[model samples]
Target: MFKTIKNDLPASIVVFFVALPLCLGIALASGAPLFSGLIAGIVGGIVVASISGSSIGVSGPAAGLAAIVLAAIVTLGGLENGGFEKFLVAVVLGGIIQILLGLARAGIIAYFFPSSVIKGMLTGIGIIIILKQIPYFFGMDKNPTGDFSFLQVEWDNLISGLLNSLNALLSGNISVGATVVGIIALGILLLWSNVLAKKAKIFQLIQGPLVAVVVGIIFFLVTQGGSLGLLKEQLVSVPVPDSFDSFKGQFSFPDFSAIGDKDVWVIAFTIAIVASLETLLCVEATDKLDPDKNVTPTNRELIAQGTGNIISGMIGGLPITQVIVRSSANIQSGGKSKMSAIIHGFFLLISVILIPTLLNKIPLSVLAAVLFIVGFKLAKPSTFANMYKLGWKQFVPFMATVLPMAITGDLLLGIGLGLAVGIFVILLKSFQNSHFLHKEGEDVNDGKVKMTLAEEVTFFNKGAILKELDNLPENSSLELDVSKTRYLDNDIIEILEDFAHKAKERNINITLVSERGTVENPPSYIEFFKLRPKAS
Candidate 1:
């Protein structure tokens, strides 16, 4: 894993910067203590990465689970009654459930997701990142950083929130300093990634996002007390502790007393199902994004995520999942192994203790600028065009996934809709491609029609086959060839038998040819298939 330290170390630093605010923001959104998110991040990075077979996937507290976490907290009797502590119980149980799922080999479900939907997922997330960061980019951020759902914890949706932010900006409530810093940071990122990094190895070693952040801090320092000075709210907000003992107070243990609570068990199952799904989807997407195209073991990822969540909950943290934003950041920043994820966790651990005060000085707008690049890279215009060129079969499902995610802010709903569309497309193709007529000149001239069955015909093909038989010219001789067919559905066999009965009325001669043998006006098409060798 250390073989690529030159790459992984720099990437880890980038992920560390990207993850810090998200950790705090998601915790805040979930109505949990600010430190809990950091705990999840630390455990996800260190524990999860250490156990996972995925080299590039970075697990952490997910925004997707924020709503559930918030609701679960309330249902568990609110924070006053150790609500957060009880939620931790659910998280631990959820982790155990995920481990069971992994052991059951349920990760195979990830393989069934269509490529079009997966690409759509990546693109949709890209668009979401861009959209969510727009307010932050303009220094009008009101919602949390990592909240990706359509409905935010703040009660307003993305569109309304953005409109409100814009209205505020138009009323001359703009943060000029934040905007200026963000633009400079974005420019630095572009220059470093596109040009400077290519020109020298030193540029690559020192990542652009890190430089942009440093520049943001320097700008913050120099602009203090000036008209363009940033407010405390405009900067990173890592909770500071007075001493080592006080720092220890930030950690909260789960309340095992809630273990027997029915509500806690329900919440546990919910988290298990949702977290596992998100993890599997992310594993698939991350593998696609990898430059080397390394495949992650999905089952192992589930087990690793489960272990991470268990540890995180034991110390008070939100549920963990394989988060795409951080994983994408790690990959874009040149992370080559799990070491980057592990090191980033350590960075989160060390920085919160040693340098959180300095971290607090970095402008949120600069981080916004960093995410803008990540968003743009994921949702490039070229991707849409490419998907379009693949035709409706691919494009429809892609849009099915992208639109819901971008518009409604529901990742699972979008994927569900896209998967439905993908399945429909498959069935449609199967219906249309069941069989083809060979217009050989000799057969046509002799009043004979030859229909070749596809390699595999399922029940979906029954309609097309029935329609073709009904349209066959009267008194024509038909050559039904299944020579190349391997698996034919019983429904299709029934269609052929029914057609044979009609052929007698039209005085049509039917010749069935197969690898088994040939039959002239076979009395039973089903019986013939029954006699043929069955697949071993």
Candidate 2:
């Protein structure tokens, strides 16, 4: 772990900056107290990171959960009396369900997803991040929430906000001082590694995000005077606890009385499923990006995430999952082990406890600048180039997953659509090749019915194969040869069982042959067929 310090330390700083605003934003979106987001962020990082087996994956309060949290609060607490504390109870129950899933080893479901769909998911998320962060960057903060839908803003609200900004510009209500400093900070971030740092080699020691954040803080301080047109209110302001005890008092507990409510179970199950899926997907993607090409243990990761969520929820934190954005940043920043993830968690814990006031001094616009860069990196031109190079079979699913995710605001729904399309493609290939022929009695005979196995068969193949077997004429001689087959799935074997039962009704003779063996005896087909073990 110590050997990872060089990479992990820098990576931790990047994740810390990325996570800060998200914590606040997600909290704001969830209709929860602003401090709840910080609590979630702290727990997600420190608690989840400590337990997760993934070297590069980062866990946090996700934007994805904001909608659920908000809805649960509204429904369970009653619209007028809705309290965020009730929703916390649902999150705690969700964590318990997640732990059960991990013990059941259900994390292996992630392996069934195609690589194309996974790539599409990352690209879709990247696009959403870019679009959502634009308003924040431009200082337009009147939108309802950060839900990942393509729903348009209310026409009146959008027009009014634009007009308000325009009027503010004319009346000098806008902060020219903050805007100027933000531009300079963005410019420095864009060029620091390329121009200034190279020219002054010693400056290279500072990371870009650290520099940008530091410059932003200094700019806030320098422009705090009345003459500079920067108001203290314009800066990022987190709630400051008056003392250590006051800060500790902010922690919340789950209201287990609500656990008996059916609604609580529904929300809990939703969180468990979505959070687990997201964590598994992130784990897979992060492993792909790891320079060392290390493969994380998926089941172990599930266990870690489950443990994290249980802890996080118990302590008033939001549900935790392995987040792709932070994990990708970790990989890009040269993280070599889980130490980077663990350290970032510690950073979150330290920052909130020791420097809450200091954090409030940084500008929200500067944090937006950091996310803006990250969003762009995820949806870069090179990503498109690489996907296109893989051809339509890959690109179609990628787009099918991405486009819907961007439009519908549901990650799982989009991937489901993509998987549906992928399965259709496979079936088309299978149908085109579904033919078999054989020579019997020394030549082609009138009593022989040929059969062919689909290119690949699974449990889903049972119906089609069974249908064909049922249609065969009585007293017919059938030869089932799978010599040219690539995959003879287990579902097809079940279909064969159906065929055996029907053999007496049709008065049919059946023969089975493959690369390994041939079956002549009616009752010995299972023993006659020899299958090679599938390659791992």
Candidate 3:
């Protein structure tokens, strides 16, 4: 893992810049202390990256879990009565459940989702990330950089951030300092990626994101609260304690007293299910995005994530999941192996401990500019166009996943709806044609009916097979073909066996054909399938 440090180290710095604001933003969205997000990022980088088998995936506090965390914090108690601490218990328990799920091989659930749905999910998240950052990009987002939910709450309004952003643009209302810095920073990033990156090794090693951040700091000082200077609310803010001991006091412990509470388990299970699904989904998307095309071990990923969450929660952190944004950023920045992920997490930990005050001056808009590129790369117009050209079977589910997620800001809901659509399509196709059925003779009423089984017939094909068999007339020959079948489910085999027995009573001559030889009234196809064909 360390062998690629030459490549991974620069990538790690880029991921660190991308992850820092998000950790704080998602925590603010989750109604938790800003410090908790940092804790999760730290654990995710160090513990989870060390254990995970993924080469490019990164783990941290996820924005997708923000709403759940928000509600759970309120339910357990408010910050006044240790509500946040109580929620930590649920997080720890949730990690335990995730570990159990991994051990039980529930990670196979990741493979069940269709590729189209996963693609749509990636595109949708990209769109949402772009949409969420617009207000900050223009410096109209007057709130701290930590609140980046789609339903942004800025200037005392919940859903008005976007409108305000446009109005600000029209009315010449803007964060002049932030906008100027952001524009220059975006230009620099574009130059680096498009022009300078291939020009020399030093340009590749230096990285654009770190340079943008350094420029942002210098801009802050230059402006110095002048007419066009960035205000306090427009910058990244990491809570700084008065002293080392005070910093230690910010660390929170889980409240085990609430472990017996039923509500705790409810929240625990919810987080476990959502976080696991999110992690698995991200694994699929990130693996696809990897240029090297390395496949992640999903079960091992689950165990790593569970371990990260356990450590994060015990120390008062939000829930952890393998996040696509940071992972995608890592990949785009040329990260190799898991060392980059580990290093980024270390940067998060060390920055907060040593130079948080310096980090504070870094403009949110500059960070927004960095994320803007990440978001655009995720939801490029070509991606959407490609999906549309794939036909409705692929396009419909793709849009289904994108629209609801973009609108309601719920990741799982959109994925569930898209997956449901994909399954419904499968069911329809199964019902229409499990296999071809035709008459052997020209006259359908007087001729025998011949049935050919599909290559693989599962229980889903039972209805179609049953309908065709039941509709057959008495006193006619029925030829059942399974020559091409590789797998025949027990349910389908049972249906066929019962039909053969009934056909005999109806005076119908039922002919069976297969590599396993032929049988008129098969006692049990289950046994037939298990038996070897005769050596003749």
Candidate 4:
């Protein structure tokens, strides 16, 4: 993991910059202490990265869980009445539950998700990232950076938020300085990534995001107090500690006293289930994005995340999950292994300890510009065309996931919708594919109608197979072929038995063909099936 420090170090720096604002913004949105977000970031980096099997996945306080955290905090009692502390207890308990889930092999749920749906998720999130950041990119920083949900912490959903920013821009209710700096920063990033980085090894050694951030800070410093200057609200805000004691004071220990509360347990289970789901989804997506295509162990990843959450909660941090944004950013920045994630965590810890004031000087717009590239890369036009070319079996589920997620700003909802569509398509195909019919006199010139069963005939095939049998002409000879079938459902066997009786009354002579041998006018279908060996 440490072998690619040259690549990982620079990539970690880029991820750190991208993660910093998100950490703060997610905390702000969650109604937790801003410092708690930083704590999650630090632990996710140092602790989670160290334990997790994932090479490129980055864990942190997830924006996807912000709404749940906010609701839980309010439900357990407001922040004033030791609510946040009690929530920490839930976080720790959630970790325990996640560990149990991992032990139970629940991580296999990730494999059940369709590839089209997963691709749709990545693209949907990319579109959301771009849409969410537009306000920030244009210097109309109204909403929190990391809150990916449709309903904003401020007001309105994603579309309205964009319109609001556009209106603000037209009405001159925007920061010209931040916009100017953002444009310049974007230009620098584009030039560095597209042109210069390809020219030399040194260019790749120093990343574009880091350069963009530094230029943003310098621009802010140069324009301070001028008409075209960035306001404090337009810049990254890390909670600055006045002293060592105060810094230590920022950490909030879990309120173990609330362990007996039923609500706490409910919240704990909710977090465990949601956080695990998010982590698994991210793991699958990250593997797809990986240039090396190294598959992370999902079960191990759950255990790692659970452990991270336990440590994070004990130290007053929010719940942690493997986040796609930072993970994708790390990949885009050339991160080769887990070292980048670990180094980025250390960067979070060290910066907050030593140079938080410096970090605060960077402009939010510049970061928005950096994320624009990440979003574009994920939601490229070519991906849409490619999915379309794969046919409706792929494209339908892809759209079902992407469209709802992009419109509603709900990730899981989109996945559920896509999964539903995918299952329906599977059933439809199964129903259509149950049997292949060789019409009368096609195979044997004896006017026999032959129906070949599929490789695996299940209850889902019952309707189609029954319909074919019922349609057979009177006095016709029918051949039932199961030579290709490996496993046949009991329901299908029963259907064949009923068809046999019906065929006898219709004067149809039945011939059953199997791998064992052909049966002539079998008396008991079940008896014949029982004599055959079970599928391996």
- Model 2 has an lDDT value of 0.69
Predicted structure 4, TM vs. truth: 0.81
lDDT of 3 by residue, 168-195 (tens): 8999888778889999899999999999
> Which prediction has more favorable TM-score, 2 or 4?
4
Model 3 residue 75 distance off true place after TM-score fit, in angstroms: 0.7
Q: Which stretches of candidate 1 lie over 4 Å from their true place?
A: 142-144, 150-155, 431-536
Task: Kindly report which residue stretches of model 2 are placed more than 4 angstroms away from their true locations once superposed.
Answer: 78-83, 142-175, 195-205, 225-234, 430-536
Model 2: lDDT of residue 362: 79
| Per-residue lDDT of candidate 1, residues 111-230 (tens digit) | 667778888999999998888876677777654466465445443665676677778778967789989999999999999988999999999999999999999999999999998798
| Candidate 4 C-alpha lDDT tens digits along 1-536 | 77899999999999999899889888988989999999999999999999999999999997788889999999999799999999999999999999898888788777666678888999999999999888788777754467466545555676777778788888988778878988999999999988999999989998888889999999999888888788788888888889999999999999899999999999999999999999999998897788775667788999999999999999999999999999999999999999999999999999999998998898899999999998999999999998897678779989999999888788889989988997787676554343443343443446578777777665445445655776778888888888877766554675677677777788999999999999888998978997888677
How high is the lDDT of residue 410 in model 3? 75
As a whole number from 0 to 100, the lDDT of residue 35 in candidate 1 is 95
Candidate 4 stretches with Cα past 4 Å from truth are 142-144, 431-536
Task: Count clashing pairs, candidate 1.
Answer: 0
lDDT of 4: 0.86
* Count: clashes, candidate 3: 1
Better of 2 and 3 by lDDT: 3
